[model samples]
Target: MKNALGSVDSVLLLGGRSEIGLAVVERLVRDGARRVVLAARGDAAAIGVRLKDLGAEVLVLDFDAERPETHERVVAAAAEFAGDLDVVVAAFGVLGDQAAYEADPVSAARSMAVNLGGHVSAGLFAARRLREQGHGTLVVLSSVAGVRVRRVNFVYGAAKAGLDGFAQGLGDALHGSGARVMVVRPGFVIGRMTAGMRPAPMATTPEAVADAVAGGLRAGAETVWVPGRLRAVFTVMRALPRAVWRRVPR
Candidate 1:
């Protein structure tokens, strides 16, 4: 049902423990979301307590990005939490070391399963629920690296590329169903996920990405870039020739 936020009352964050996802949840709560369903791999009691303290009715659910078979159930459980699931945030991802990925193809494949295949399954389930309900929004966390793969992190980039493309296609498929999809592309998040990694030229924080996503919801934007400048930067990077782009170090 509708709330003071102007549209939503319930939100489902796939990556409940994700910094960006939690930030987005905070924004939504401030915007009048009355309920929140946090789905993550481990126990979500901590986050649930924090959200409950913030005045949100919280529901904790078990979710594993590496397990596609569980995605449908997760979506169903989210819908059950709030008769009308107004928003779904697909923010689960893993950034493994490039060297380690190179050394172990099996481990690298698992990364792809979680990053790419997981989104595919999760997106489809979320879309079906939203479409059938005839209202809702799906926020997919994409990456700028997906705009164009880089040699240093091509594997991760490739996975995001696949996810980005999938989200775009799903958005189109949901066109006229009263359900919308917003894709968020951030450059580099220097939070817990990338704690030790060097910040990119256009690095951003989880809060910034969450703010952008909140703004996008109000504006009904199909896509958003955290910090905004990354949009312009990627415009140039996407057009660069491979010969010249390959020399640029990460």
Candidate 2:
């Protein structure tokens, strides 16, 4: 449950090893979250230790975003381990090579399955639990790329666009159910995920995004844009003519 100060008590991070997800969990723990469940495919031992050091009861579970069949069971197990998840972060995604996706359409479909389809399953499952318990926040890590798909990474952008819409609709559906969703749209984040990539204008870091998410959670914001100014940037970008937009470099 969330305390009077709007601080959560427990958190479930679907992308346990994600730099942004771990950063958010770390911030929440520092802000008084006592229990955390990290669900991901690979080992979470290091993050578990880090969270433990921050005074959280940490539990690491195996979760595969591509495996929709196991999502319900994973959510159930998380609930069983940590009663009433106050925050559930859906941060798993893949930014595959655009050239590869262009060559292999099947690969693009697989990536979409993880980014958009997996969230559809996990988001609904988490929403049901939050509704049953009557209070919680589901944090959906969307991207500015979704706001206006760029030609360079349209495959990834398309998936994010779909996810952004789904998250917004889900939030609306959960209104007045004592639960809500926070959609975080961040500009290019210079983190483990975007390693070796050229920095985009107004690029941010995982820590910055996490900070924004934590502040948004406290303020009960339905949507948050990291760096804050990206909201206005995207508004203009979204309005640009296709002729001008298509020429914008990656």
Candidate 3:
């Protein structure tokens, strides 16, 4: 049996415990991915064991997204598990309280470091690996908030915007390396991360985003908008003048 992409044999998900990341991993496994490395903050025993039961050679690794210095070691560990990584998903992030962030610039900056800086370090390492191998996919979880900063979560949105731009530049840099990057911009995802939050229009689930990601991979798309309409929604949102944009309620 071939994987959804028809050739992916191994996968490395950075935020292994992430609901969206795991959903994508599950889909890839069904598609023929035989080996997987789920690297997260703590023991991924539950997820690893589950995948093991599914017939994949699962490896659990320690990954701290906030510690950029350790990113190379994490990538190295992935190489030790799978010689040629078919897919690498960067899906670690935090949705801090907007009010708290507004109160403490320090906290907001730390959030940005984790969300954007971590990706920068890990992505570079993964890109180098993929470029050397000459074939692989890097999946980046961006957000619609990044399309246009809103007053509700501008700090988080700004970090995502930085990450989004970095992914694009990295993609261009790897144009001829046979390494591709897929950016997923999903609208409000009512997952563990967004628990207790009001669902946005066209809000989707992890499964929905996973399905969209699978489709994007198959189509070789550089960017994917979950619910598929966010692309258009943001187009108009971005065009709205500052006065109207500022009044959006949190």
Candidate 4:
């Protein structure tokens, strides 16, 4: 639940080690979030130290995005740790190599399961808890690639498209429940996820994404675009003819 002054009292971050996710959690803690639950497959000690330095009570739980069966259990653990989840950040994904995915269809399928299937289960479970509490926020980190999936990375983009649509429909389902969902669509983020990848047009950073997310939460926005201009760029890009669009570039 939020404090009287509107500061988030507790938060649950699904991807504890994600650069963008960690940045958002740090921003939230700086704003006023006191209790935090970080779920990740690996050790989150480094992340824990940072949040603890920011004066937050942190708890870490083992979480594997590839396993949907454990999502409900993780959410319940978070709720048990911190009375009511005031905010939940669903940020976990893999920026897989398109060529590799093409060569190994099985790998691509697994990636899809983690990127899309995992979110579906986690988001729904969180929504259930939020609805029961009648107050909370779920921040879904989507990508502009979903708006217009390019051949260079269609596998990853396709998964994001599914996630974006799911987040929107889920938000609509929770209307008037006081448990709103905020969807963030950022362009190529130049961070750990894309360390050596070529920088795309209007590429943003994890920190920038975090800042936009914080602002969106404060404004109660359903959708937010990092740099605030990609919305217009994608609008035009989406209107291009198939032939011209395909020939534009990777």
Best by lDDT: 2
Report the candidate with higher TM-score, 2 versus 3: 2
Per-residue lDDT, model 2, residue 103, is: 99
How many clashing residue pairs, candidate 3?
1
Ranking by lDDT: 2, 4, 1, 3
Consecutive 10-residue window with the lowest summed lDDT within model 2: 1-10
For model 4, the stretches where C-alpha displacement exceeds 4 angstroms are 1-6
lDDT-wise, the better of 1 and 3 is 1
Task: List, residue by residue over 93-212, the lDDT tens digit for candidate 4.
Answer: 998999999999999999999899999999999999999999898999999989888888999999999999999999999999989899999998999888888898889999899889
Model 4 CA RMSD to the hidden true structure, in angstroms: 1.2
Q: Which ten residues in a row have the lowest lDDT in candidate 1?
A: 1-10
Writing each residue's lDDT as its tens digit, candidate 2 over 104-166 gives 999999999999999999999999999898899999999998999998999999999999999
What TM-score quantifies how close candidate 3 is to the native fold? 0.95
lDDT of 1 by residue, 1-250 (tens): 5433336689999998888999999988987888899999987778787778889999999999888899999999888877788889999999998899999999999999999999999999999998998888999999998999999999999999999999999999999988989999998898998998889887899988888998998888999998898888889988899998999778
Q: What's the CA error at residue 133 for candidate 4, in Å?
A: 0.6
**What's the TM-score of every candidate structure?**
0.97, 0.97, 0.95, 0.97
The segments of candidate 3 whose C-alpha lies over 4 angstroms from its true place after superposition are 1-6
How far out, in Å, is residue 156 in model 4?
0.3
Relative to the true structure, how large is the alpha-carbon lDDT of every model?
A: 0.90, 0.92, 0.88, 0.91
